[model samples]
Target: MDGQLMAFTGVAAGMVAMPGADFAVVVRNALDTRKAGVATAFGVAGGLLVHTALAVAGLAAVLVAVPVVFETVQLLGGAYLLYLGAGALIAVARHRSAATAPSAGARGEVPGPRPTVRLGTAQYLRQGFFTNALNPKAPVLFLSLLPQFVPAGQPALPRTLLLATIVVGMAAVWFPAVALLVDRLGVWLRRPRVSRALEATTGVLLTALGGVLLAELVLT
Candidate 1:
């Protein structure tokens, strides 16, 4: 059991370290505000809890068994990603336009307004939650990975929960560390040009991931 626990921890750590949609979202939010980033991290952890519960209850197996159900979830998740990506791009465009637009002065001179980006706590949290939860892959991953560590004839639920807790705990630790690290660089990232670039890059990556999911559904 100890060996299995160690193995699971190592694997989970690797997964947490890998940059994925969750990482992208967290970094993006963190670049904007440390609080937003931290909130997003917690939201991602919340999503993991949901996935863990589904796996423990064996509901994830049903998703795998029913192609239609799985495909539907994939489509919804893909659409959500697309929406977020497109919204980000649109926001950037709007910001740019606003920045360039002429502003009236007392002497009839015009000046550009400073660009700004703000996301409420609930919004960022929701974004993080959905980004992680909607992936469909997360639940599947838990379903696949957790079983390997469970001893034969042992109660699966307790073991699964224990393993899932480890995974979530790792994410909680890793993501906030990332947020803090990024926060250290916040001064430079807050610059208009750098901020816009980061936003665009994150948006593109998210959109691309969404496209891949949708393509997989179509092809498979």
Candidate 2:
């Protein structure tokens, strides 16, 4: 149990820091609107809760039953990570361009469809719920990787819930800090060259993570 907890914590920590669809969406929403940042974060986290539950229930079993499918998931996850990393890099590059800079708008003015029109307290709640729910990786991650931590013949539900809770809670804590940090470092982060570099680095990390996951699947 101790080992499981520690491992889960490490994974959770990594996930919280890593940029994903959830991270991008939440950060965009938070930065774009008033107090919507909190709402967005919560929305993403809420989505995680649903994913966690489904993963713990029977999804993990399905993955374990068909190892090939599991491998496919790992490959797909890696690809997804790469895609996100590339997107961030592209955003950074585009923002750097003189043509795009004016259109980038001040601080929060990237023109597009806003995540929400309501902008009420409820909007925040809904944002948290939907962002997490819609994220496919959240469930796949829990189902694919978490079972490795379970002990043989042990009832998995309790452990799964615990792991999921840790992940979600950690995300709740870490992502807000991220929002603040990103917001604080807005100028530096938004700097086209710097943003591009960071995005590239993150992209590399994602690809590496994918490689690692694939390797693990192969070894098993």
Candidate 3:
């Protein structure tokens, strides 16, 4: 069992390292505020808990077996991403407009650094949670991955739970590590031009990913 767990750990590590929409969300938020990034990172971990529960309770199989259920998850996931992406792009436009618009600076008053949205902790956490929870891929991965790791002739529940916990633990560590690294670079990332450019790019990437999900659902 130790050897099996070791192998599973390696596989989990690889999966955690793979950049996905979760990584994008973390980076995007982290670039804005370190605390937001950290909160988002753990919120994703919390999402893994949701998947773990579904997988453990064997609802994931139901999700997979029912085409309607799977499609609904896909639809929701795609729509959520699209919503976030559109929001980011809209923020960029508004910020740019604000920068150029006539303001008190036009008079003798000195202008302050342009105001930007600073999401509260709970809101950031929700952003992170929904970003991961809505994605069908995590549930699918949990459902498939855990069973493979459980050794033959062993009680499945305990082993499955342990393995799921491992995946969640890795996510807890890995995503936050990413957020911290990005935070360390906050000095430069917070700069207006660089920040806005990255924000716009992340937005486009998210929107494209969402589109791909919807397209795949259609094609499938």
Candidate 4:
């Protein structure tokens, strides 16, 4: 691999792998339904494709020109993280309430909405796609960060495509493994206590990530 390519790949992979809204959403879906997780993973990958194409096509340059654009994206990304975190916290609260419900405990009925066949794979996929796609930071990151790694004279299109492929490939490897692991874990992952803790942790992480992004934006 070209040195630049290697560096770029490392950066892209690191960025994608960082636990954020995207990672949280996918893992949540996987734990919720293994099949749906697979679809969600693919959908997130599709959003990456769009970002990669935008970067390679030079559309990102438009974003680079206005400092405000990057700042705006950062703010939006921060807000998104906050929103996701709040949702996770809500799930945790619901889980706790359900677990303690007197009648439910006595009757052995879970207090939450049971997952049904209605929560199909397509819905998860669509959720994943929209969640990642709607987040402004994703495309902005590709636009702002990716070009920095491209060599001065190289055909950016090929380089950009290569970078995107490698990053997405890494995600393909990591998330399905997560899905399979969750599948194998079976009922353990579905336990109310387990779900509540997971959601709570994810919520905290998202909030922290958002705070960091917001600070970075303010400083920049």
When sorted by TM-score, best at the front, the candidate numbers are 3, 1, 4, 2
- For model 3, the local distance difference test gives 0.87
- Residues 1-220 of candidate 4 have per-residue lDDT tens digits of 7788788777766777776677777777776778877787877777677777777787667766778876776687677677767877777776677668798789987565323233677777776665566566666677777667778998877777777778778777766676677667858876766767776887888778778788888787
Over 1-220, each residue of candidate 3 has an lDDT whose tens digit, in order, gives: 5899999999989987887888888998998678999999999899888999899999999999999999999999999999989988998887677666677448655433335689899988999999889998777888888999888999999999898889899999999999999889877877767778878888898899899989999999
Clashes of each: 0, 7, 0, 0
TM-score of 2: 0.57
Worst 10 residues of 3 by lDDT: 107-116
Model 3 stretches astray by more than 4 angstroms: 100-114
Error of 1 at 47 (Å): 0.7
Every model's TM-score: 0.89, 0.57, 0.90, 0.76
- Over the full model, what C-alpha lDDT does candidate 1 score relative to the true structure? 0.84
TM-score of model 4 relative to the true fold? 0.76
The lDDT per prediction is: 0.84, 0.62, 0.87, 0.72
* Total backbone collisions, model 3: 0
Residue-wise C-alpha lDDT for candidate 2, range 87-164, written one tens digit per residue: 545654554464345545565554432122346767666755654564434666778877887778888888777888
Query: 118, model 3: CA deviation in Å?
Result: 1.8
True lDDT of residue 78, candidate 2? 53
User: Who wins the lDDT comparison?
Assistant: 3
